[model samples]
Target chain A: MVKITYISHAGEARLVEAASGQSAMEAAVHHNIAGIDGDCGGVIACGTCHVHVDGTWTDRLAPPGEKERDMLAYIDNARPNSRLCCQIVLGEELDGLVLHLPIAQH
Target chain B: MDIAVSDIERARSIPLDKIDVSAPDLYLRDAAHPYFARLRNEAPVHYCRESLYGPYWSVTKFNDIVEIDTNHKVFSSDASVGSFVLDDTTLNPVEGGIYLPNFLGMDPPKHDIHRQTVSPIVAPQNLANLEGLIRQRTRGVLDGLPVGVPFNWVDRVSIELTTMMLATLFDFPFDERRKLTRWSDVVTTRPGDGVVDSWEQRNQELYECAAYFQRLWAERAAAAPRPDLISMLAHSPAMRTMSPEEFLGTLALLIVGGNDTTRNSMSGGVLAHHLFPAEWSRVKADRALIPNMVSEIIRWQTPIAHMRRTALADFEFRGQHIRKGDKVVMWYLSGNRDDSVIDRPFDFVADRPRARHHLSFGFGIHRCLGNRLAELQLRILWEEVFERFSAIEVVGTPVRIPSNLVRGYADLPVVVHA
Candidate 1:
């Protein structure tokens, strides 16, 4: 199991343990975490599952692909650290990653 | 048997150049599969030099479609280039203009604001509130079906339920609900193809519809805020001051959006079960799979076959030089069958893991607003169906709608076995 923290738009941080193969978006969706809509089910579409990766952990993860970046560009409140959580596949390396959710996904 | 084999062989031998899946007659016969298959294999981004809607490019592969749908800079949904379909003809005085002022045809900040204004109607909390009403209505419609006899499922179940939902959303008179369906058909149908005698007639009918809705708008505007879509629009700052033309256009958008997508899916789901009994059996055996099954059905059916977007500027896509103001048709029907992303794209699997990941609801900012609501309606419908009927058997060949868009049945003769 891999542990990750999701900070909601409301500034509340919640930690959960997700399996190695599951994505951070899936974990949030499965647990009904606030603000991670994941409406497209992680297809790199909709861009509803956006999250701001903590500055410290940003270097640890691989950079988003062109498609993911394109979707990120359309999202509101997209920051330099913003990444679609659906694209962030959970693994042992991401065990302690932290993500912050935006106020509105639309 | 020998003749059937030869027919299949003959279908296979037809050259890719001879195949044009855009013809409505193919869909009328429910025979677009082989054409799309050949196109996907031979040319993912196939071009048709001449057709009814004139020259247009077909993007078949899954990845290519996503690339086009996401990159709105080069490829645009703006009304100036062309409306969201191949046919740019409109009865309005302005040639090659979008007849409606809906956000679906607009780009950027304008689209964002209008879409945001109406987004609350299908928000999660609102859907949760609507769950009970949808289930109740589904039960009513199912319980009233004619059992053990051939009945038009399209009319009896699909159209009835969807029209009811549309009326509720618009706060239109429930008794005159069929008018909503008629207006939706008028808005989407190609004039003089039997839906209406001519564009003049279609415009008259649409004007009648606008007059009716205008009255509703007047009533809603005077009353306090309400949850219905008309009231929502009446109360909205951005939409409240829309001109009559803009009002009619927005109404067309909401009416068609609320009508066709789910109505056709309802009929398509029944037809799918008939074509693939094994998948139906899997769904029947485990009701837990209903949610995923709903997504799979939408993907397989793809109620709306394609959405056309015109190029705003010249851009190279999938090795094709798409020039400025070119009509590019993203065949959702073709992309849903793309083998690269979806395993065994031909087969209908109820519990496919990536079920919700389909191109039916489109992608990006303009994805179907009522997607979750459509899913909820289908899920509750199946649950209620399972409790009441043993099976919904298709007794005769369904008469599919003869259109490149709205890939659905016109008359599905079905018999329920309780």
Candidate 2:
């Protein structure tokens, strides 16, 4: 199992465990975590699952691709470290990774 | 000028020469697969310099569509961009000078505000409350189907169920619910077609629709705030003061948004079962697949084929020089079939992974508002189908809708064998 922490815009953190192959977005959606809409079901389309990876764990993650990067441009609160959670696949190596959610998922 | 050719015959005989995927007849005959396939393979972002809808760019690949759908800034869906369809309003304005400025046509602040006003109607709480009613209706529609006898599923099942739900959302007169469907059809219908013989008639019908809804608007405005869509629009600060055309536009948007896609999806789901019996059997055996199956159905059918947007500025896209004011069509139908994104894009697979990943409900701020509700309806539908019927067989080929915009069946003959 892979453990991950999702920090809401309000700064409330919720930790959840997901299967190794599942995405962080899928884990949040499955656990009903607040602020992670994942409306497109990890399609890399809707940026509703926008998340800012914690600085410490950012190095372990692969950079966003053209599709994800293009989608991120539409996110109102997108930052250089921001990533769509759906694009981030959880693995044992990145256990306990943290993601900060945007206040609004529009 | 030389001779008249029917769509079906032309579809069968046409060579691979510069295929026009925008041709309405190509879709009318349900023969757009090869055309779109060619586009995806040869030129993902090809430009059609001339067609019935005039010059437009076709973005056929999956990632390309995602780029356009997400970047609403450069690719604007403004009503002036011809209301998200190939019908170029710049070339020929809609008759009666009627342009409804719904949020789908607006950008940023205006779009967000307007969308928020009606968002609560489909909020999680409301959908939870609506689940029981939807299930009851689904049970009624399925249980009432004629067993072992051919019937029009499009009308008996799809239209009946979606129209009922639309009425519930709008709180329109229950007895006069069919009027909603008629108004929706009229709004999407093109001129010179059988739906409306002339543009004048279409405008007249829409005017009547406006007058009827105007009464409802006044009633809702007078009464205390309610949960119905009309009331939401009537009472909300952002929507309350809409111009007549804008009011009509919002109403049209709401009505069609609630009607066509869901209606077509219901029919399309049944047709999917008929087309793929093995997959249907797997889904029938394992109810867990219903949720994913619903997404696959929507993707396979792509009820609304393509949504048009206009280029706000000259830009480079996928190594192509797209000029300002070019009509760009994101062919959701073709994109859904993009093998790069979806595996075995042609076949209907019930257990397909990440099935909810589809372009049918669209993307970004303008993505479908009623998506969850549409899924709930379909989920309950298959649940009831499992309990009631053993087989819902297709009796005849579906009569396809003759428009490039709304890709759906007008008549789908089917029978349930218990």
Candidate 3:
């Protein structure tokens, strides 16, 4: 299991232990994390699963793909550190990942 | 049961290659289910050589529809090349038909910019602000209804609530709100479905709609920016300079997008509850199920039956050879019922898991902008409904609209028992 920290827009933080192969979205959804909707079931189609990766860990993750970038471009609160967590697969390499939820899912 | 059996029999009798699911009458009779079921079973990527709208390919399965919807690069919704509906004439006018160009029909870059301009109005913050008002209005409407007597739910409740919501969105004159309803109907209805007699008449009515909005636009434009859609469009640099046709198109899109889709779903929930009383009872017994039930209702209604896209270039999709410019209609109605994706696809399960995952809101960039707002409206409507009435019985046969484009009702005679 990989440990990840999810900080809400209100600064409330929750730590979850996600299986290595699953995406951050899958884990958050599995844990019934309040903010992440994962409405498209990890297809990167709906922008509902948007999150901001911690600056410290942002460099560890690969940049979003073309489809992910296009979907993110339309998100209301997207920023340079923004990513659709569905694209972020949990692994031993990113065991102590920190992510921030948006004000709300569009 | 007789209708279902006959529909299946008729659907089975037709040759696989000859089945055309675009006929308006099929939806009018609510008999399109068996035909779509056959398509999903036999030819998920089925093609019809001809129909009132002309030859088009129907993507019936849920995954196939998702694939096509997300791949906007290959399957374009640009109105110039074609349109987002099987009838291209609506966007590309011929003689009597009007040219209505809006963001929904445009491709990326342009579609992205224009869509972003007004999307904030339905953003979560704005929705939170509007929730109390929506709930209050819903209560008002519900309190006014005559209980234990059959009335057209479509007119009395669905139309009334949705129209009032649209009026609030535009800050449209409250008394004149029904005009928004009329304009929405005009935008979707073709000649002689009872809304208008001919395309010329439809055009005339639409121009009146345009004029009415233009008057509002002039006022809103001259004033400081406000929260209403008209004010936002007037103030936004990206939208203010839209062409007259584009202005009308944008208004039509917003009006219908905000109006008809939710209206049908409100009526649909009543119908679904009537058909599936057990599920309704489950919801009433637990108010927490309201949100999930809203999603179920939208899926069951599949308010906007199909969305069409034109292939940008020749491509092989799901092993079928689709040429450039071929009209591809993603049948959301069929996709929502695909048993492979949805367990017991026909039954309305209020607490169904992953209820938010459905095709009612088309996938990708052109997905419905007012989705959350629509959900808020339905949620409020049902919550208020439960507080007032123990049951809403379908007292008479529901008369469905005869259009493949809009799977809706003309009348649903219902009686609310208090």
Candidate 4:
């Protein structure tokens, strides 16, 4: 299991242990994390799973793919590190990865 | 039963190339399901050579729809090229079809900006703020419903609640709220569908709608910015410079978008529970399942049947050559029932896992902006319904609206049992 930390917009940090091969979105949703809706079920179709990866851990994760980037373009208030966490598959390498939720998912 | 069997048989007997799912009568009878199911299995990327709206490509499968919707660069929604609906009349003024250009029919950069302008009204914060009032109104509406006597649920509950919400959003006068409903019906319906006598009448009613909103726009513009839609449009930098036609077009979009979709889903919920009484009992036993059940209701209703996009360039998609300027229609109603993605798609499971994952709201940039608001309305309605009525008995068959675009009902006869 890999440990993932999601800090909500209100500064509440939630930690969840996710099985390997599950995306960060699945992990957040499984743990009942409030902010990440994952409404499209990890398809990267809905931008509800948007999160800003911690700058320190950004390079440790695979970069956003073309589809993810295209979706992010339509999200409101998206920043440089904005990525759809559904595209971020959690594994041993991603352990201790931290993601910050947006003020609200558009 | 006989009609359904014949519809299925007819769907199976028709040649693959001859199937045109855009016929309004098919939807009026609610018999388009069989045809769409066949198309999904045989030709997920099927094309019809001829139809009333002209030949178009239909994307029926769930995943294929996601692909087409997300590939906005190639599949353009620009009104200039082609309107969002299969009918070219929405963009062209010929034949009594008014030319109304709004953001839903525009491409990115422009579409993005205009969408962002009105999006905040339905955003999480605004929805959170509106929840209490919505719940209160819902409770009032439900409490007023006649118990143990047949009533038109569509008129009494669905239309009333949604029209009230629309009025609230626009800050229109409460007493005159039904005008919003009238304008919404006028915007979507044709001359013969019963809403209007002719194109001239439709245009006249719409002009009155436009004039009324224009007055509101002026008043809101003169006053300070408020959270209401009119105030927002009047105050927003990007929206304030809209032309008269653009203003009317945007207003029409909001009215129809916010009104019809949720109204049908509201009625659809009762009908779904009537068809699947077991599911209703399960939900009653577990009140927590209301939210998930709301999602299932939206998927089952799929208020807007399809949204059409024009091909920006000649491209090959799913092995089919889609020529530039070709009309591509994404049948959201069909995709919502694709069994591969949704387990037991035909069944209304109140506790269906991953209920939020459905194609009722289109994917990508042009996704239904008021989705959360719609969900909130349904959720609150169901939650409040649980507090009062034990069951909403569907006493008769629903009179469905006859439109290929708006998949909805005109009347739903029901009796509330306390």
| Candidate that scores best on TM-score | 3
Each candidate's clash count: 0, 0, 0, 0
Greater-lDDT candidate between 1 and 2: 2
Off by over 4 Å in 4: A19-21, A58-66, A76-80, B1-3
Q: How would you encode candidate 3's per-residue C-alpha lDDT over B1-418 as one tens digit per residue?
A: 1156777898999998899999988888899999999999999999999887888999999999999999999999998888898876565696467899999999989999899999999999999999999999899989999988889999999999999989999999999999999999988878867788898899999999999999999999999999999999999999999999999999989998999899999999999999999987888889999988999999988999999999989989888999998999999999999999999999988999998889999999888899989999999999988888999999888999988888999999998999
lDDT of all predictions, in order shown?
0.82, 0.83, 0.92, 0.90
Q: Is the docking of candidate 4 incorrect, acceptable, medium or high quality?
A: medium
DockQ of 2: 0.24
Which prediction has more favorable DockQ, 2 or 3? 3
Model 1 stretches astray by more than 4 angstroms: A6-23, A26-43, A48-83, A87-95, A98-106, B1-18, B90-98
Residues A1-106, candidate 2, lDDT per residue (tens digit)?
A: 9999999888999989999989898899899896777766676767778888998788789888876876675555568889998888888998989999876565
- Per-model TM-score, in order, reads 0.87, 0.85, 0.98, 0.96
- lDDT for each residue of candidate 2 in B1-418, tens digit (9 for 90 to 100): 1112454355455553456888877777777877787778778898887787778899999888978987888889887655577875311255433566788788776887887788777765688789999999988888787899999999998999999999999999999999999988887777754578776787788889999999999999999999999999999998899998889988888888888998998888888887788987898899988988988898998999999888999989989999888989999999999999889998889889778778998887678877878888888888888888888888887888888888888899998989
Task: State how far residue B407 of model 2 sits from its true place (Å).
Answer: 0.7
The candidate that wins on DockQ is 3
lDDT: the better of candidates 1 and 4: 4
TM-score of 1: 0.87
**Candidate 2 regions with alpha-carbon error over 4 angstroms:** A5-23, A26-44, A47-106, B1-17, B89-92, B95-97
Give the clashing pairs for model 3: none
DockQ comparisons of all candidates to the true complex: 0.29, 0.24, 0.77, 0.58
Least well predicted 10-residue stretch by lDDT in candidate 1 chain A: A69-78
* Superposed Cα deviation of residue B248, candidate 2 (Å): 0.5
